[model samples]
Target: MKIRSRRFKHALASLSCAATLLLAPLASSIALAADPEKEELKLGFIKLTDMAPLAIAYEKGFFEDEGLYVSLEAQANWKVLLDRVITGELDGAHMLAGQPLGATIGFGTKADVVTAFSMDLNGNAITVSNAVWAEMKKHVPMANGKPVHPIKADALKPVIDQYKAKGKPFNLGMVFPVSTHNYELRYWLAAGGINPGYYAPAKGDITGTLSADALLSVTPPPQMPATMEAGTIHGYSVGEPWNQAAVFKGIGVPVVTDYEIWKNNPEKVLGVSKAWAEANPETHKRLVKALIRAAMWLDENDNANRAEAVEILARPEYVGADAKVIANSMTGTFEYEKGDKRAVPDFNVFFRHNATYPYYSDAIWYLTQMRRWGQIGEAKPDSWYFETAKKVYLPEIYQSAASELVAEGKAKAADFPAATEEGFRAPSSDFIDGLTYDGRQPNAYIEQFSIGLKADSKL
Candidate 1:
């Protein structure tokens, strides 16, 4: 009887040990999935297709999966969106890659804005009116009757000269002053030897058209086509589906994509006020995790899921454009002329090439553009550029969220930068003019440009 009792006790102890072993991993996962301090959130976005990660996160239950109930609202414009985020009216929003940097540095509205996730890469193009295209086409090289790709700004310089000879101000449109569109347009024109102008913020001249060749002004993204159609502007730089919208409406020809201007350039980011991020650290991480998952779903299987993504983006609450128009650029092809669709698989990268990671190098590039264009107003040390990038871009938060996703088996570890990544990318001359940009050497990179402010240059 004593032997049987002892055997029963031993079996019970073994069962208890096995149960604990099984529950260990479960507990760790639960800890990782801790309740977010703020469960209900309102986020804002503009009506652009690159806001896909936020849309995908909300549509696919990735937000709910992370214990977040998010209401996605489309703001009227970028300034309004930034203001709302700054006022805590919206928890976060899809932002231009330069917006946070601009805000943090007191360029526009002084606010402590920061971004943990880079939303997408290379979704913008410069579109010229049909009339402008007709004039510019004469200078472009022909390939079997179709215009040669990339259509450098050199093609448009003579056209600008014609406008100048006629005494008409050569005007162009960019979404915002600090936007990638503005810098890209300036870069392309400067590369072609047309001065895009400068901003003397110290003199309160934020007009950015001092001593200009091509006068640039702000036009909201969705209104780009109509504004150009009204002849208010000759050409504009903006993101999809607006560029594609021009092709569909037969209003303009997308001469060059930002992908052509600067291969795989960072476009937009997921931005929130620094206070919000500090107040809800857990929520922020969960938000990033959901977005990371959404991005993975986006690029997985060679973008096999893009068709469905286009459908979601076409919904009235999101981009609200026709599915066909959105799909023109979203699904690995971009329409230049009405039928000049070409395969550009990396045109709208969300996950691949560490697109989701907020590299410091990307931030510094925007800073360099600001300085080059005089928005920064003064030369900054290379260390200052690095420090400012560190202030605005939170890679640690991204890594934390990514690590959780990898541990939970939702994402592969290889999908992100290695653990030793110092948040800088290797130097490459990916610009349309073949100028090398080493993020570590900002002044040297700035000096290579002929048009804008040099490293020691003053306004």
Candidate 2:
């Protein structure tokens, strides 16, 4: 009887040990889950309407809800913003979509930057000085005594030619070399039979003016209108409210919005250093969640909150533009010629159409533009584009944040791309030029263009 009792006692002790082993890992995982590694963060942004995601996230308390106390600073310009992110002076920042791709590939600065959240879509436009617009208006087709919508670069072509006829340089301004504005301006010019020029980085010519019809240069976003007004640049492509500021100041006329350049194009993104992301995984994911929520709020009920957003963006500490100027684009209308306000509800998309998701295809599109110009300086296989895109765009982190939003009932699952989405959007031909682009076929897409470098054409 004594031996049997001891056997039972030994069996119970083994069962207890097994139970503790099973429960221990579960407890550890529960503890590790959702807790931020670093809660206090310093984020940077340029003063643009698209920087609204970070602004909304802060003013709306999305960061604090995740136990993060974030301090937002307005960087002087895109270069300064990118530099701060690279040097760890900022936890993350509102970045041009191409900024991360440009940095990773050694275009200007070499850094391992990754983005999971795209800040907004279709916020940029091409605006010409009043004097330039007067010449352009003569060539533009009109309707009902008003200039027609989507005034293309074809209209500006005659103006550029007139400048060339008089031995004058036709200068255009873009935000950055690797910026979407740069690519869009070039695309518009090339489509209209104008040579916007090329960058032969390998040949030590960053001027991008080899056999060019229009000279393109970088002007800071805020200074763009003033620079154009000063006659330093005849026209400029930049994000709002500067374009609207031109009309308000009676200094310029916005010729085209980026929506007409590339319909539903991906614009700005929230970028972080790869090292910072790895070291603080939880914090990074939570920050994306906050940004996602902010995006959703911006687009909720088809921009019901935009008036509030415009107010927030107009503050001196933020965009610092007049509320009316900011509202010109933010509130579903854009002023082209001072009084030519038209409805463009998608003018500033924050969340709808999966704008927040960082797709590898978007990265590839930017890279193809870099190569098409002279920034890439060489021809690479399509696989190289794919691999580079995956390395730079952290879609896995986007999924994690999106999944949390869906699970908590904060957002619907249908609002995100399918969990099985391959990070490439369907091949689209929605640009003003009507050129179809398949991200999977970068080389073929390059061959489609009449101007710019081709697959065999190297700078």
**Against the true structure, whose lDDT is highest?**
1
- Candidate 2: the clashing residue pairs are 198-208
TM-score of each: 0.93, 0.93
RMSD of each: 9.0, 10.4
What value does the lDDT take at residue 386 in candidate 2?
Answer: 97
**Model 1 spans > 4 angstroms off:** 1-33
Clashing pairs in 1: none
What lDDT does model 2 reach? 0.89
User: Model 1 over residues 1-459: C-alpha lDDT tens digits?
Assistant: 002223444565679978889888788566445679997788899999999998888878788778777888899999999999999999999999999999999998999999999998899999999999999999999999999988898999999999889999988999998899999999989999999999999998999999998899999999999999999999999999999999899999999999999999999999999999999999999999999999999999999999999999999888999999999999999989998889999989999989999999999999999999999988888999999999999999999999999988998889899988999999989899999999999999999987889998888
Task: List per-prediction Cα lDDT, in the order shown.
Answer: 0.92, 0.89
Worst 10 residues of 2 by lDDT: 1-10
Count of residue pairs whose backbone atoms collide, per candidate: 0, 1
Identify the runs in model 2 with alpha carbons over 4 angstroms from their true place: 1-32
Model 2 residue 184 lDDT score = 89
lDDT of 2 by residue, 1-459 (tens): 002223444565679978888889787566445679997688898889999988888888788767677878898889999999999999999999999999999888999999988888899999999898898899888999999877888888888888899999999999988889999899888888999888887888888788899999999999988898889999899999999999999999999999988999999999999999999999999999999999999999879999999999999888999999999999999889878889999999998888998988899999999988878998999999999999999889999999988988988899999999899999999988888999999889998988888876775
